[model samples]
Target: MTQPQRDCVIAGGGPAGMMLGYLLARAGLAVTVVEKHADFFRDFRGDTVHPSTITLLAELGLREKFLALPVTQLCTLDAVVEGERMTLVDFGVLRAPDNFLVLAPQWDFLDFLAQEARTLPGFDLQMDTEAIGLLRAPLDQDAGREDAQGTDSAGDVLGLRVRSAGGDQQIHARLTVAADGRTSALREAAGLRAVESGVPIDVLWFSLPKPSEPPPATLAYVSSAGMVLTIDRGDTYQSGLIIKKGAFPAMQQTGITEFRTRLVAAAPVLAGVADTLTEWEQIKLLTVQINRLLRWHRPGFIAIGDAAHAMSPMFGVGVNYAIQDAVALANAITPQLRQGVVPERTLAGVQARRERPVKVMQAIQGRGHRVIARATVGQRVLSLGAVRLLRLGSPVLRRILARVVGVGLLPEHVRTPPGGSR
Candidate 1:
C-alpha cells in the first residue's frame, strides 16, 4: 500500500506533537500526529496550565472556551515550610490578564486541543498508532555525509515507521518531529542522546477523597517529616509524597503504616484521613528525572517537550515548555514548509530559540533538587533566619517567581497564518 506524503508527521501525540500539528494545519499544511494510546485518559499527567499558556490560548481564540472546561485556578503558588507560610509565586503580579495557574486534567486539555485541531481541514490524529523507528534515506552507499547548515545535513529523516492496529507501515513526510517524550524510542532511533542530571527524589502518587473541610489551597505542605503536594481535582485530592530516589522498594518493605505516617506528618490536615490507604496497590510511583538534549534537531527531524528536555516536576512547567516549543517550531518553519521542503536551518532555529529557556528552567529545577532532597529525608529545609529573610523579601521573590513560572522567559505568540474552520 502507498502512503501519501504529508507536510509533517509528528511522533507522539503529546502537547508538543498535538499543538504543532494544530498550528501547522492551521497554517494550511497537512500534518498528522500519532499516539500510542487509544485515548488521553491517563492519571497524574501534568495538569497545571500557567498564565503564559492561557495567554497563548487566548491568541488562538481559545481562552474563553478553555476556561469553560471544568478547571480550577490558583492565583498563588504557596508552600507551608516548617509551619511558616511562604508564597512562592504570586500570579497576580504577572501582566497577563487573569494571571492564574489553571489546573485542568491533562486528558481534558488534550481532548480540547484534539477537538479544535480536528475542525481544521489538514489535521489528522492517529490514536493507538506507535512509531517503531525512523525512516532515513540511504547515504548513496557512503557511511554518512553532511551539508553546511544544520545537525543532520544530509536530509536524512524521511518520516516514521509506525505500527497500529492494522500492523506496521511507513508514513512519509518532508519533516518529522519526535515529541514522543522522555523515554522517546524515536529519539533513540534518531541517535540523539539527552544529558541526564542527578535527581534525588521521586513522587509517590495516590488519591484521597476531598475532606468535608479541606485543608488550605496551596501547592505543597512541607515539614521535617516529609513533603506532600496537594492538588485539588474536584471530588478527590490528588496528593504526592516526595521520597528519596530508589526508596520505594525499602518503603514497600517497611509497609503502608509507615507511608501513612509520613503523609500525615507532612500535612497534618490529613492526619486521620490517610488511615484508609491500607494497601500498597493504591499508590503509584513516578520516577522523577531532569534531562535535555545537546542538540534538538537533525536534518528533517526535531524534538520538543519531554522528548527534548525531561523536566523535573518542580513548578509543573513541563507542559508549558512543550506548548512553547510547538509554537516556536510552527512560527519558524511555516513559510518554508508552505514552500515545500524545509531546510535544516529552520529546524535548527527552533531548537536554538527554545533551548536557552529550557536550560534556565532546568537549572532552577536543579537548584531545587537539594531543597527537595533534604525535605524528603526529614531535614529542616528553612531556618528561622531564612524564614525572616523570606518574609522581608517575599514580595520581590513572589513577583519574580510569578514572571518566570507564570509568564516564563521569552513567551511565543501565534504567528502562523490562521487556520480555517471546517
Candidate 2:
C-alpha cells in the first residue's frame, strides 16, 4: 500500500524524532514518524535532563508540562573519591529558572511527547514500521516529470519503503530524518561514516531493589577503576556502574554480595542499601564510545540523536543533546519552509545551525570521558583538584562547572533546554 506523501518523515520515534515531529507539525508541516517497536517499553535509558535542556524546553513551550511530570530535581552531583566525599559539582550556578538537571524516565517523557504529537494538526505516528533501506532513485530529472506537473512541484523526497505488520508500504516525505539510534539503518544506507574514539570507561546499568527510603539527588563515586552514577528516578534509583570495558561480566558473576562489597569498598556510605540488590540479568552494559558522524545531512536525509553522535555515559548528557538537535533542526528549517524554500536548502540551514552545538557537545563529552578514564594517580589529582577548586567558588570555576552540568554560558548554540521533549 502507498502512504500519503508528507512534508517530513522521521524514522525512529525516540525523543529527538518525536520532538522534531511536534515542532515541524506545529509549524504546519505534514510529518510522519515510523518506529520499529509497536510499544514503548520501560527501558532504563537516559533520564538526566540537564539545565541547558531545561532552558530550551521553555523556548519550545514545554516547561509547564514537563515540570508537571513526576521528576526528581538533581541540584548537585556528589562525588565520593578514595574515601573522601565532596560535592564535586553543583548545577545551581546556572541561570535562573533551570538551574539543575531534572531526573525523569525517558519512557514517560517519550510517551508524553507521543500523546502531544497526536493532537497536532499535521502529525502521524506510525508504530511497528521498520525502515529497511533508503529509497533514492539516482537523481533522474526525467523520472519526476509527472510530479513536476502536480501542485507540489519540488518533487522533494519520495520517502521510504518500510516493512510493517500489514506488509510493505511507501512513506513519502520532503525530508527523511534518521533517529534510529547508534547503529542506524538509515545512516548506514546513506553511507555516513561514524568516527569514534573509545572512552576510558564503560557503563553497566543494573537495577537494584527500589529503596524503601528515597535516595539523594545524584551520586558519583569516582575510583581508580571508574565511576558509578546513582541517578535518581522518582520511584527507583538507577545505578550506572562505570568500569573498565572488560570488567562487568566478571563482576556480575561475582554475585550480589560480592558486588555489594565492591561497591561499598568504593563508596562505603552506599553499603547500607546493598542488601536490597536483586537480579543483574537485566543489567545493560554499554561500551563508552564517543563517536560522531562526519555528516549530519546527506541530500534529503538527516540523522539526529544517537544516530548522529553517540557520546560516553560519563556525564549523562546524550539525551539532552539529542533534544537540543531536534529543537535546532526544527527552529532553523520551519521558517525557511514556510517561506517557500526547497527542503534540501532548508536542511542546509538546519545543518549549519546545528554544527557548532554538535561539535561543542562532542568535545565536552570527549574531555569528560577522559577525566573518567584517568589513571589512579591522575584521578586522585583530579578528584582532589576538583574538591579544592570547588571550595573556592570562584567566578571562573562556577561558570566552567555550570557548563559541565549543561548550563553552558555559550550562545544559544551550546545551550540545550533541560526538560524532556514534552
Candidate 3:
C-alpha cells in the first residue's frame, strides 16, 4: 500500500498543538493534527492565557473574540504571610496595552481556537485520532533509497503510525511534531531522556461557591496555610491546597466534612461555601512536579510543550511557556519551509534556540519551588523581603514581576522569533 503523505503531521491537540496548527495552516502548510480525545474540551486544566499569550492572541486576530467570552481582568495577586495577607505581585503594573490577565475557562479558549482553526484552508485538524508511533523516513544515505527518490526540494517528513477505530494506519510527513502532554508517548518513543523532580508540595484543586464578596485578587497561602491557594475561577472560587502526598489518601477516606475542615483551616472565608459543598468528587489532586528533556529534538522529530519541560504550578508559568514554545516553533520552522528544505541544521537550530530559554525557565521555576518550600524562619523572612523587593526593588524588578503575572517582556529568545534579529 502507498504511504499517506502530508506537509506536517502533529501529535496531540492541546494548546501547543492547536496553536502550532493554527500558525502553520495560516502560513499555507498542509497541517494535520491528530488528537486522541473525541471531544477536545476538558476541564481542570490551565485556563488563564497570561499577558503574553493574550498579546499573541491579538496578533492572531482573536483577542476581541477571546475578550468577548465570559472572562475577568485579574489585576492583583495576594498571599497570606505570617497570618497577614499582602500583595505578592500585581498585574496592574504590567506595561501592556491590556495590563490585566484574563480569567476564563480553558475550554472556552479551546472552543475559540477550534472555531478559528477550522476556517483555515490548509488545516486538517482531526479529532479522535490517537498517534501511537513515529516513523523515520529512509534517510538519503540508506540503501535502496536511491530509488525511493526524494522530492526536488521539499523532503518527506519522518512518518507516523496511528490507531483509530478502523485499524492501525501509517502516515508520512516532512516534519513530525510531538505536542503531547507530560506523559507524552511521542517523547518516550523518540528515546528522549526526561528528568522529573517532585516538588515539596502536592496540589489539590476543588471548587467552592463564589465568596459572598470576592477577594481582592488571586489568593495564595504561605507555609502557614500549607502553602495552598484560592484562585478566582470564572463562576466560582477554586482552591488548591498543598499537602503531604501521604496525607491525601487519609483526607479522601474521611469525606467532605473533614475536607472542608481542612479547607476552612486554610482560609476561613471559604467556610461559607463549605456547607454548600455538593460533591467532593469535583476535587482533583495533582502531584506538582517539574521536568525537562535532555534534548528537545532528534533528526526527524521534535517535542514541545510539556513534552519539552514540565514546570511546577507555583507561578502558573506552564501554560505561558507552552504557548511560547508553539510560537517559537512556528517562527523557526516557517522560514525553513520557505527555503524549500527541511535540513538537519534547521531542526537542530529549533532545538538549540528553544533549549536555552527552556532551561532558564526551568531553573527559575525550580528556585521558586525552593523558596516556597523553605520552612526556616530566616528563609520565610527572606521570602517576604523578596516579594517586597520585587515590588519596590527597581524599574526592572517591577517590569519583570508585571510580565511574570500578565505575560510579556522576557529574554530575547522569548520575545522575538529565532533568526529575526536580522
- Pick the TM-score winner: 1
| Candidate 1 local lDDT, 1-422, one digit each (tens) | 33799999999887888889989998889998999999999888998998989999888889999999999988987788888778888898777585899999999999999999999988999999999988898776554554343234443899988998898889999899999998998877776778899999999998887677876677788778888998888877888999999999999999999889878888888875788798999999999999998788887899999999999989899999999999999999888888887898888788889998999999999888888788877798777788788888999999999988888888999998685322
Sequence-dependent TM-score of model 1: 0.96
31 Cα displacement, candidate 2 (Å) = 0.3
Q: Say which prediction, candidate 1 or candidate 2, comes out ahead on lDDT.
A: 1
Location of the lowest summed lDDT over 10 successive residues in candidate 1: 146-155
Q: Which sections of candidate 2 miss by over 4 Å?
A: 139-157, 210-215, 252-257, 339-345, 374-390, 393-396, 409-422
Model 2 worst lDDT window (10 residues): 146-155
Clashes of 3: 4
Q: Lowest-lDDT window of 10 residues in candidate 3?
A: 146-155
* Model 1: lDDT to the true structure: 0.87
Write down the RMSD of all candidates, one decimal each: 2.3, 6.1, 5.8
Q: Write out the backbone clash pairs for model 1.
A: none
* Alpha carbon deviation, residue 273, candidate 3 (Å): 0.9
